[model samples]
Every structure is written in structure tokens, then in C-alpha cells.
Target: MKPQLANRVHTLTPSTTLAITAKAKDLKEQGIDVIGLGAGEPDYNTPQNILDAALKSMNEGKTKYTPAGGLPALKKAVIDKLQRDQELSYEPSEILVGIGAKHVLYTFFQVFLNELDEVIIPIPYWVSYPEQVKLAGGVPVYIEGTAKQQYKITAQQIKSAITDKTRAIILNSPSNPSGMIYSETELQEIALVCKEANIWIISDEIYEKLIYGDAQHVSIAQVSDDAKERTIIINGVSKSHSMTGWRIGYAAGNKQIIKAMTDLASHSTSNPATTSQYAAIEAYTGTQDAVEEMRAAFESRLEIIFPKVTAIPGFKVLKPQGAFYLLPDVSEAARMTGYVSVDAFVEAILTEANVAVIPGSGFGAPSTIRLSYATSLDLLEAAVARIDSFVRSKWQEDLL
Candidate 1:
């Protein structure tokens, strides 16, 4: 008999961004000058101090396993970070350090959800949220946030979607594909709905440090004591410190939830790497100069590239207030270029224009495409130019 795979994974849709990136990589190996803007990470090297700290920990023989939740010293650093940045106080018992924010969130769902539970996930969500919930035997309920709404779901929308089966809502401000941050007023409204519904709030703040311009990041947990009591904050040093490979992310929340997540981790990953945990402690306790420098670079790129992107024939973009991605509605452009779907338009842009971009269908916004500004300004400019030329040429051909 043939080996059978689990039904949960069989229905899972693979990440479109990674698939596009892999196709771009294949083109690059063939010596095609394909410029990829699908990366969901910073292009900068890890800060020198963080690298040095990791090495220092190894030299000191701190390689042994620590507590499944985290090193006590690292937890202290995380606690201090929360107090300093968010003005929130937390004991070590309320913190759980895991491999990354992604893993931490996965562990959270595994421990918190039961079969047939419902999780309210805002549409155009990060690719993993729905998949993780399904793996935990939970159903994903989506609320659409149109481009006119800056891709943000409303509190009334949340209230309307609630059912007795609702277990939690996954909120990612400074959202992944859209790059939009919710205002403090908006967060308060959402908090009220969650409180009334008595559902948990899973606040993913991994991109907190990468905010740009006059935009501010206010965690929903900061809305009120009741909000904080029910919210679990998922954050990490990956985006903030260019430490993606180091794999250190932590969750701060109710002690009981933290304990359950930590217990699950003990049986699974055991704990995050000790060296990475030491590096994370340094990330929280050390200077944030590099974080600011990277934010500045991304902001500068956004200012330059946004105008160019909007100039592409039939492309419409909402100026992103935070994060490093630009989600542009290209439905009109696709039609003008004689393509039936944005996904097809995206493919033509890669193969013909030699520029890789993520189709928005994977993010539940089929008319749009996501481009990362997390590359060199030179490459960004060149890639935009290619797309502009390609779109115009196809548009002209269609008119003929």
C-alpha cells in the first residue's frame, strides 16, 4: 500500500511568496538576471554586537539547555523590554521563549485550541495563521478588509463574525502583506469587541520595531487592563535585529497560557537555542542604534519606490505607514495587459519582465500583489523600471 499523509497537511496551501522566491532562485541559477522582491525579511547582516554576544556565550560554555520557557536572565531582559517599551509589567512566569514568533504562535494554538474551535483571522493575514489553526484542529473565520479600509478589519466586523464557537482572534498590526498599522482608536474599538465576546486576542508584533514615518505601534494589549489580561503578545528579534537565522521569539501573556505553551515546548523543541537566547538578551538590553538605522533605510526606500510603483500603468498603491512591503492593487493593470487574473500577470512579470513578485491570492486579496522594499535601492529601482516597461508594452499591445 502507498504511504498516506495526514488530512490536515493534505489540504494546506503552500506559501506563494516562498514558491515565487524559489522560481526566482531557479532563474538566477540559469544566469537570468531576475530581481526578486518577495522576501519577507531584512537584507542587512546581523548587527556586530549581537553576533559577538552569541560567540561570547559559546566561549563561556553556555551551550547547555536552559528551561523550556527560557533562560531566567533572558526572561528578565524580556520583562524589562516590555516595561520600558510598552509600560507593561510582567513576571518571568508570564513569558515563554520559543524558536521564533512563528513557532511560538504554533505552540500556542496547539495548547489552546480544541477540535472544531473557531479562530477569527482578518483577511490578507500572514500565510501561516490559518494553516497553523487548521493543524490545531480549529476553523479559520475571515473578515474582509478592503483596500479602501487600508486593509484593516473593523471592530463591528469582528462583532458580527462572533459565534459561541469562537476561541480567539489573530491580530497582526503593521500587517505582513498590506503593511498597515491600526490606529490607537481602532485598537480600542477592537478590544471592546473582544472583551464583549470573551475571546482571546493573539497579537502578533514581530514587526513592531520596523515601523516607518509618523506611524506609531500600539499593542491592543495596551488598550486596557482587561485587554492585557486576555492578550498574548508574540514578538521576536528576527526583524528588529536582522537575526532571522538565530531563531529567538517570545510570548508574554497570562501565566497559565504561558505555562501551557512552555510545557508543550518542553516535549517538542525542548527550548530555544541557549546561544540564541543569550543573543536575544543582548538584543533587549543593548543599544537599539542598529534597529533605528535599518528602519531609516526602509523608510527611505519606501519614499523613493512608492511613487515609481504607483506610476506603473494601472497600478494603485496605498502608502504604507509601517513594515517593509508594498501591496499594490494590480487588477486593472492585469486587465490592461490582457491577462485574465493577477496571478497570471505576476507570472508574466517574472518570466518576461525578469522581476519576481508575490501574487496576492495566497494572502486572500486576489487583485493585488506584494513587493518587498527590503532590497538595495538600486535593485528596487531597476526592478520597478522593468515592471513599468513590461506593463506598458503589454497594455499597448492590447490596445492595438
Candidate 2:
């Protein structure tokens, strides 16, 4: 007889982004020409200064276990960053660093949730939020954010979702998939609701540095003192510094909660990689020129591709204020092509056109599809053209 796996393991959904990326990779390995728009990482290389720091750490024999939470220097860097960027203050004791922002979130859910306790997650969320909550024995309650609202949930929706079982709410601005940012006014209103309900607020600000236009990244903790006390700020250099492989991310909030997370890390994983932690220190403290350069590249790509994508027949897109993704509603295209679902349309494009884009079903927005413009502009243009051709061919066939 096969050994039984834990029941919790069966409940988790594999990441659709990774699955699609892997499929594209497999086709490419088989010598097929595939343009993969499914990856979430920036195509930019890590900055030279950060790379130098990692090498220096290794040369100086600094590649050992750090404190389970993080090195003191890195924690200080995080504290300084919060003060400088968000105008929010946190002591070293109130901070805990983990393998990555995703790991920090996983650790967060593990530490904060009790069985049957509920966390209110906004719809069209990053794919991991609900799975992590479920893995941590928490029930995930979802609130939908309509397209008309720029995919942001209003304070009243949050208030309405709250029940006796609701323990927390997850907020992601400059959000993944949609790339919509919450305004200061919106955040202040939501903060008021959360404060009144006495609920914990998990603010994932990993993409905080990638915002474009006049939109600014504001931390919920920055709204007020009461908000700060209840809000846990999750951030890292993976996105900002193009250091995804380095796996360094962190959380800053109430000292008790931070301590609890640190203790959990002590047993599960000792610390974030020591060399990577050193790299992160340099990333936070060094010249930010590379960060701006990458941001400029992404903004430029978005500017060039947004119009072309919208011009595709039966497609509509919202101009993203931050992050590097474009979520275009493809329901019209799907219907016109005779596909019953958006996923079928996505699969057809991948198989017929050799262009890979993730279906929005995983993001809780089934009418849309997500394409990451993190790659080169040329490739993004080619992918969109291929998609256009594929859709047009389908329409031509239907006409017959």
C-alpha cells in the first residue's frame, strides 16, 4: 500500500504560473520556438554592486548561518529602509527576514492562523495567498474587486466580509496580475475599517518600488499609529533588486508577532542565505541607479505594448500603474473564437501560436488573461502579434 500523504497536502493547488512557464520551457527544450509570457521574474540581471557584496561575503567567510530572523546589519538596513522610504519606524526586534517574500508570507500564515480562523483575501489575488492560508489551517474568505474599481476592493466590501471568524485581511497594492495600486485615500479608508474591526492587516508590498506614473506606493502602516500597530509590512529585494535567486525577504510589525515568526524560522529554516543577506544589505544601502533603470525599462515596455495589446480584436486592457504584468480581458476574443472558456483560448494560443500566457482563472478573474512584460520589448511585441494572428485565424475558421 502507498503511504498516505497529509490531508493538507491534497488541498494545495499547484501554481499555474509556474506550471505554464514549465510547459513553455519544455517545448523550448524540445527545439520549438516558444515565447513565454508566463514567468514572474524580471529578466534584468542583479546589479554589480550587490553581486560584488555577495562575493565579498564569501571571500570574507561570511557564508554561514545568520540568526534565524536575520543578521543585525541586514535588520538595521531594513529599519533604515522603512524610515527612508515609507516614513514608518520599526526596531530591529520588530523585524524578521526569511528565504523570500513568499516564504515570509508562508511563515506569516503559519504563525498567525488557528484552525477554522478566517482571512479575508481580495479576489483576483496572487495565486499563493489562499493556498498558504489553507495550509496554515485558516479558511480563506474572498471579496471580489470589480474591474470598474481598477481591481481594488472598497472599504465597505472589507467591512461586509468581516465576521466573527475573520482574523485578518490581506492587501496587495501595486498588486500582482492586475498591477493596480491603491491610492492614499483608498488606503486611509480601508485602514479605518480594519482599525475599527480590530483585525490584522497583512500588507504585501514586494512590488512597492516598481510603480510608474504619478502613483506612489504607500504602506497601510503609514496611514496612522493604530494602523501601524495592526499592520504587518511584507517586502523584499527580489523584485526591486532583481535578486530573485538570492531569496531574501522580510516582515516588520508588532514585536510579538515578529518574535513568533522568528521562532518558527528557527526550527524550519535557520536563516535566509547569509551571502544573500549580505547582498541584500548592499542592495538596500547601495546606489539605487539599477533599480531605477529596471523600472524605466519596464515602464517603457508597458508604454509600447499597452496600445498594441488593446488594439488586438476583442481585447481590452487596463493601464497598469505598477508591476510588470498586463491583465487583458479576453472574454470577447474567447467567445468570437468559439472557445467556451478563457483557459481554452490560452491553451490554443500556446499550442497553435507557440506563445504562452497564463489564464486568469487562477487569479479569480476568469474573463481575463495575464501576460508579463518583464522580458524584452521585442519579444513582448512578437508574442502579442502571435496572439493576434492566432485569434484572427480562429475567427476566419469560424466564418467558414
Candidate 3:
């Protein structure tokens, strides 16, 4: 046979974060003083408490395969966290562990979706949602949420996107690119729509602990009893414990769905790294101090970033109620400059301004780009200054 790729492989687009990270790496290797805002990683080191626990596990020879679903202790820890943090209840059998929340989400589709089934994703979502759906032979139907909506979608938009074949909906609070946190009222309304339609809510709460302000993250499961049964809660230690590379994540839901996911994961990853599982156990069971400290720092940066970025003539920023990211409507900047897309603007800024932010196109929104403030306050202040200067200098008043 001539050169060929599987249909699934052919349809897969390389991960946007990986692509951006690779480009940044290459530039850095070549000695470019690149400031990378493209990565989705947390800057904080994995908590020492968690790290110490993993090292102890290794010393105790906990490096072998555990259960396909996960180790009992870790699963129980996750369950405990849900109960303690969000006031949600789940049994061990209802929880399924995988390599990370992304894996949990990907395997969710792989286990549940069939050819031509649809996944409803709010646009400007995490970059992986559409692709993961596609890999599972599902179509991703994106519904755009504009800056006017604070980059948050309404129940009506979700309802309009549904079809009889729509198998699931992905909801991310403290969303990656926009950093927009859904209010309890908004989630309750969306939960009602999805519950009536029997749509699966794959709630991504990986950033649950990263949220700022008095706004709370109401897991659809926490909305009410009916909503709880219809939800698969996606969570991990990556953001909460700054353990991104430790590669442990899990989800909880109705046991039938959890069983299917475990079956799929059994043959695929088998189990997450045993050491990572031990580390994650500590993450859930350990102190809340590290997480609180990080949130405070992010809140501090948000205050600094909002005023400075918005001061730029074409930039429109909605003070994000949560998450460490800010997605300013830079569509106006594109018009005033010669750049036709956020991708082009990102490239220009990196080349001329030496600052890197992910293009909105990657997050399924072309009018906005994601600027992460997950770094030091000084760097965030400096990056925004450079971005402000670059956009202002290129302002030609729609000349392009």
C-alpha cells in the first residue's frame, strides 16, 4: 500500500499548546529572548508535600500497576475532595482515573461516542475539546460566545446547538483562554436544559481551585439531584497542585458511564503512573495552603493586568471573574493594524514585541487571544506593557 494514515489520525490536528510550545522552544534554542505566554502550564512547582509523598511511595515500591480504574486510596481521596470542596458525593466505583483530566475527557468520548454523534462545545473553549471529539468519530459543534457575553454562553445558545444525535456537552468553568467563570445561576439554567435533553455534561473543573472572587464553581452535579446523575465531573491536580507533569486525573459520574470509561482505559493506559497516583493522593488529602497562596497571587495579577491591557486604544477587556487568563477582544486591533487574524497578530507580537500569547483561533475564537498571568507579577506587568505598546504603535485606525 502507498503511504497512508488512519482516518482518525488523518483528521487529528496536532495539539495547539504543543505546537506553540515547540515553536517557542525552537526560537529559544536559537537564542531569541522569547517571553512565552503560549504554555497552559502553571509556573508554581508541584507542592513539596505532594512530591514528598510520591518519593515515599517509590521508596515503598509503589511503582507497579494498580487497578485499571485506579488505586483505592487515590479514588477515595478524590471522592473526599469532592465532598469537602464542592459538597458533592460519589462512591469509589463511580470514579474513573486516567493519566490526566485531558485523558479522562478524551477517553470519555472514546468510550461514549459513535460515528456521526455530535459534541456541543461552547466556542472559545479549551483547544483540545473539538479535536478529542473528532478523534472519537464525533463532530464538534461550536457555539460562539462573544465579548458582549463576557465570553460566556447562555442556556439558549446551548439549546439551539443540540440535536437528537448530540451525545454530550463540554463545560469548562474558569475556562482556559477566557478565564470566565460561570455563575451558579447560569449553570443551573444550562443544567436544566441539558437535563431535559438528557445531554451528558462533561464538566471540566480542573481549574476549580484557581478561581478568584466570591463567585463559586457550581458543578452541574451540585446543581440538583437530577443534574448530578447527568454529569461527569473532570478534575485533576495539575492546576490545583501545580503537578502538570505528574500526569494524574480522574472523573466521577453515574457508575454505568464510569464503568465504560474504566473499560476503555483498562486497555489503553491501564493505569496512571503509580507514583503519580500516590502524589495525587497527597494533593487531594494535603493542605489547602499552596492552592490558596497561588489564587491570591493570581488575583493580585488580575488587578494589575486589567487596567493596563484595557488602556490600549483597541483592546477590550472584561474583568474576568476567575481563572488566571484574560482574553481581550483584539479584533479591533487586527483591523487597525494590517494583521487579518489573531494568529498573525500573535506572530507579529512575538517577532517584534518579543512577547507570546496564544491566538484566539486556537481556542475557537478569532476575535480574542489568551494572555496568561500565571507567572510572576513583574513578568505579567512587563508582558502587558509590551503588548500595549506594540498594539498602540501599530494603530492605523482601520487602514489595513
200-316 in candidate 1: lDDT tens per residue?
A: 999999998888888999999999999999999999999989989989999999999999999999999988999999999889999889999999999999999999999998899
User: What shift in Å separates residue 347 of candidate 3 from its native position after superposition?
Assistant: 0.8
**Candidate 2 local distance difference test against the native:** 0.93
Order of quality (TM-score) = 1, 2, 3
Candidate 3 runs further than 4 Å off: 14-19, 398-400
Q: Rate the local accuracy (lDDT) of all candidates.
A: 0.93, 0.93, 0.86
Give the distance in Å from residue 13's predicted Cα in candidate 3 to where it truly belongs: 3.2
Each prediction's total of clashing residue pairs, residues at least 3 apart in sequence or on different chains, is 0, 0, 0
Candidates' RMSD to native: 1.2, 1.4, 1.6
What's the TM-score of every candidate structure? 0.98, 0.98, 0.96
Better of 1 and 3 by lDDT: 1
